[model samples]
Target: MRRKAYDDLLAWKNGKTKQALLVTGARQIGKTYLIREFGGGEYDHVAEFNLATDDVTRESFLAARSADDLALRISIAADGPLVPGHTLVFIDEVQECPNVVTYIKTLVDRGEYDYVLSGSLLGVELENVRSYPVGYMSELMMFPMDFEEFCWATGLADQAFAMARDCFERQTPVPDFLHERLSALFHRYLLTGGMPDVVAAFVRDNAVDNVRTLQADIRRFYNRDITQYAPRDRRLVIQEIYRMIPGQLNNPTRRFKVGDIADVQRFSQVQDEFLWLSRANVALPVYNVDEPKGPLRAAEERRLLKLFYSDVGLLTGTYEKRSTLGILDGLGTQSGETSSSHDRMNFGGVYENVVAQELVAHGFAPYYFTGKKVGELDFLIEDADGRIRALEIKSGSRFRSHAALDKALVAPGYGIDEAIVFAETNVERDGKVLYLPVYMVSLLHRTRQLV
Candidate 1:
């Protein structure tokens, strides 16, 4: 599978002054696979090390005194030669041996061989290591495949995405046939998500049961990590918060309520627990902004927030297990068929989750707006021109705006000139608001550039 991060790896390899690269993300998102693939294609020899499984490799890092010494030990362990400018040295699962992180500075200073380091729970494990090579390493964040990458992996042609982009740029409706086809594909994405293994299973076998099984296995792996890595006394609290994600999203307000899971009266009691989860990349939280204005982060409401599962496929699997609904059976609705009303209602949360996931993947901090006398806006974003835009997400075709959006559009202090509504409708404009299908959320970055 192709990943957008591959291009970043290439840039790092060919830079004028290169430094060791660190790739960080949640587990099962393909960080290791991408680095290995890039190393194999771009270098003469690739020396790979896995600290999680090989005790000899971990011991070698502890014994080495200099960059040259470390290179010699890594070559021996990898059964390969580390030639200057000819070999790509990859360190996998480095978090398992956090002591080695600081040594990256020495290797980069030597500037002999290219280096790439990847790990899961990197931030959590870094806290245990005393010192870090902060200035000596360039960092890149990896995410589950975005919509366009998912299309490429699933056999969609480049022209298809180009057509969608053109439509979005011109603010024109896609041809009816293309719109239906993309909608069906988007629905499938909701079930399979961007996890490489889960998506590969669906593409190869076209079996929903297989996909569901894999999602459950991934969830189990995450559960095990919580037990293994979290502090002993807080293990139960972390698990409780993880299990309560789906229910918290179902609330009408959509802000995570600590009282729902435990008897805590103040968020301060569980603030660290939430931060731990966020750092692990298991949960994506959208902080509330009291006033919609410049520097959105300035007015953030830390206590009032919404939490979304990192992967939508996992969210759907958990929802199915709790509801006992046959969500997998509804995968055939990608051909313009309407899902049952029950399924539609269930998809509301899934739709919002995908929007949040895409926004984060595209380098946007998600924020929401709510007024006392007015209503709530689903999402708020700043465009390239420094104008705040209100985004409302609706799962059904009967989309409507609330007074809050109208007020924000004209409010001098708010500075929102345009509002966007994402729903199951064709592209159209209503006064200052533009209505687009939910799948077009992936094209938002390009649309912003065009504006």
Candidate 2:
């Protein structure tokens, strides 16, 4: 499947970067496959090793004394001398032997071969990989296939996006036929998600059941990771927190209350558990901001927040089949799944989750705004131009009644000029507000740089 990160790999390879490349993300996000694909085409010989599955090689890497010794050990394992400049030395599952990262700098300095390293759980596992070569590494964070990549995998034509972008900029409605079809496809994208393996299976079999099954398998893998990577005492807490994501989001406020996990538990007690999950890339927590400002992080209230699954497809797998049908058929606003104690008629949480995923993948830090006077906005993001914009997700038919957005527009002190209502409707603008289809969330993006 086509991925946006492949371009990043190509740029790293062609840039002749002296720094070794580090590809990091949650497991099964296609980190290994992407690197091997790039290395195979760009290098005459791609020597690959995985520390997770190969114990002897892991020991060899850890015992190496110098850059020359590291190269010799790798060549011995590869069964021959690696070509000086034509070879790409690829390391996988470096989380098992993080010292390999420290070696990356020395190897790059030798300039014998191009080096690329990748692993999962690095945020939690590699924290102690002492002596990290800060400037000697270029890092890339890989997310699940975003909607645009999903569109490409599912055979949606390129012109469709071109047309949508045109209509979005022109403030015109998409043709009725295209709008209806695109909406349906957007639903499919939500169910299948951006997970490459699941997306590929859906593309080939076109089976929702198979997609659900595969997504479930990935969730199970995540469960096993908790046992393996998380601290023994924190494992149960992390596991429970992961399972609670769906029901937590279903709440009216969509705020993750620590008390719900256990009546006596407090946020300060399990703060590290939440950090573990966040760093592992298993769950995404969008904090509440005191005020929507240029740097949204300044006002972020970490304790009061909404937590979403890393992928929406995995999220849907946690629910019953009826909820899935409700989403597909566009039956009503509420999923109406009554099996769980936290069940609700509202599907706003699911819609909010998808939008959150889209925003994070597009390189934006999304926050929710709730105030005594301004009410709650589903999402607030600071644009590249350093102005905050309010975003709302209307999953129900009552999309027109946006009290929060209306209030914020003229709330006096916020200085908010524009608000977007992402609903299941055609494109239109009402003064400072722009109403866009839910699928167009993929189009909300801008490039930014840090000082």
Candidate 3:
């Protein structure tokens, strides 16, 4: 329930010439709850309205003559006067009424009221919203809780979280006790996801079944949106694309190639649908990085773009029980499922994407390295000095340095400062690359200087 984004809102409230703000994120990410928590505590009076649940109120605003009249209508609906500096008005699910975006823009432009509008999906509503107060309004992006935040929330706080936060200068090695606990929780997070409701359930019941049920409910919400939000013709295509996510990410080439989708019939039909999904924040496109520099331009090959869902747990939910063999071992039983061939391929790809997702959330952009012949580096992470650090992520621990990694290091111009091979446990260096556990990837961002 504690989110750092709320702090940004407070800072915005206290700023000079503060404008109405718009908060955007995927569905059920606690957008509404965040506004209420932040606004109620910061302002003298809080008036909240949901455009999706309250249609009559929306209709009244639509019929109003001007922005001032619309604000007056909202105040009447809330059974209070909209007083500036005293009231913080919040409109949740603003995507449910596209017309309101323009109205809010006009109100902010005309200085009618201080407000915050939150939307789970704005791609559907952007069609009608015109003349956005671009310069006047601040847009805030909210993401699912990161590993550190999750630890703090679940009462698992220890040195790992502290170290990741850079509370100290030197890198603190995760002690054995902390590593084991964190490893288990990380696996659980990969299963249950950061969806607020599911996370709350896990915290409340601590039951795997409860978490799975909640995950299913979130999937159902997504499935329903395919029909509810997308056009009839685009509905099935969107559904198919959604279904292909787990398999696509699990491929030897993590990129989402058109050939991977069975019964594609046509790739063009699904392309726009995929873009819509990305706009909704349900799917994130990890572009193939040809350059490690800032603005990390996507490769000329558009087909190389990889697709990752908003949550790792949501991705796992799509696979059948049998297919998830090595991908995950489930609650507490480690059955050594990684031995199977199918499990090996699928599991490896998923874990790589997981690492990629986590690193991206931590302000690191990942790029892959491929040799002229046959080897490939899983990722090339650029540190603060603009130095490229090559990294290879494995499923568990069974990884041998590839020829591509060797070729990458010896290549002409690109000078890699350090090479890392991330596995299941910390180990010594193998030739050019240093071996580290997958859990230690967060620590890769900073250098370990001895005191």
* Candidate with maximal TM-score: 2
lDDT of 1 by residue, 382-440 (tens): 76566777888766544664566777777666766568888777899988889988889
Q: On a 0 to 100 scale, what is the lDDT of residue 362 in model 2?
A: 84
Best-matching candidate per lDDT: 2
Name the runs in model 2 displaced over 4 angstroms. Answer: 79-81, 334-345, 448-451
Pairs of colliding residues, candidate 2: 334-345
C-alpha-based local distance difference test score of model 1 = 0.79
Model 1 ranges off by over 4 Å: 65-69, 321-344, 446-451
Position 237, candidate 3: lDDT: 74
RMSD of 2: 2.8
**C-alpha TM-scores of all predictions:** 0.92, 0.95, 0.85
Q: Candidate 3, after superposition: displacement of residue 352 in Å?
A: 2.8
Model 3, 1-451: lDDT tens digits are 8876777787777772747888887888788888999877887788888888888987876687667788678878995666776888898888776666677766776554578888877756565576666666777767677655566678875666664334223333456676567667766666666777778887888765776777778878888887788878788878877777877776676767776566665556467878878887787766555543333443323445677887777776666645554434422112122443544333665566567767765666566655455366677776666667877776654456355677767776666778777666545565676766565665455331111
Residue 419 displacement in candidate 1 (angstroms): 0.9
Backbone clash tally for model 1? 1
RMSD of each: 3.9, 2.8, 4.9
Candidate 3's C-alpha runs over 4 A off are 109-113, 158-160, 164-172, 262-269, 291-295, 298-300, 320-346, 363-374, 380-389, 400-402, 415-418, 427-435, 440-451
Cα lDDT tens digits for candidate 2, 343-451: 2346678788889998988889999989888788889988888878899888877777888889888876785656999988999998888999999999988662211
